[model samples]
Target: MDDINAWVWWLVGAAGLGIPLVVTAMPEFGMLSVGAVAAAVAAGLGGGVVLQVLVFVIVSVALIAVVRPVAARHRTQLPELATGIEALKGKQAIVLERVDGSGAGRVKLGGEIWSARSLDGTQAYEVGQEVDVVDIDGATAIVM
Candidate 1:
């Protein structure tokens, strides 16, 4: 034990924590590894075991208690974005073919052809008419 240095032990601890970080993909382990490195620096500078341990504990706990919540908050937040077919809903389309609710019709939506149907089953749209997209049923668009 006397042949090896205390800083070496601290470095080994950091490496041990790093293993879990890579294997489990847990950011907490990476935080702890940083603390271990800080402790190793203290040990290399002749810090007492108590001081080194205090540095490690304070750093690790502080990172977990403070940074974790902020990181989690940012991670869970999503930008205000409408994606996929939902983006097409409520948009206007030009009827390329006569649209009858009970009949297959085509519309030019977002510069592409899309199958369209009337919102009301009895309603119909004429060719070249512009209508609002109401909903989507798979590949079909419901327009009003």
Candidate 2:
């Protein structure tokens, strides 16, 4: 309505922008919401409509240009965390029983007993010997 202040309209616009940001999980909407807030500040300071619009556009464009690439770069980078079987590979295990290529044996790996076999068919690991895990085959660990 004509009676409503321009700053109040800008606040409403910001809230409207916030809805899509929440629902879609898009950062651009959030940047636009911040721009709306900047426009609201301009309105509160008695700036003309063109000045308020200019403030909104400049703030929105700046945020999008700067934040989007940084966010994309972070998203594309891989985390340095390894879990489950992946964490077991290349780890040291103590042979609980004689480990050989011909039969299954037990090894204490990461504080747990795991079925193990030798990586090389002719090689064998004696009890209390330390071995390096090479790979995981189902429930068994291949060690050397």
Task: Output the number of the TM-score-best candidate.
Answer: 2
In candidate 2, what are the lDDT values of residues 1-144, reduced to their tens digit? 889999999999999999999999999999999999999999999999999999999999999999999999999998689899999999999999999996589999999999999999899999999999999999899999
lDDT values for all models: 0.94, 0.96
Displacement of residue 83 (Cα, Å) in model 2 is 5.4
**Residue-by-residue lDDT tens digits, candidate 1, 1-144:** 899999999999999999999999999999999999999999999999999999999999999999899989999998578899988989999999999897499999999999989989999999999999999999999999
Compute the lDDT of residue 104 as modeled in candidate 1.
Answer: 95
Worst 10-residue lDDT window for candidate 2 reads: 97-106
Distance from true location, Cα of 105 in model 1, Å? 3.4
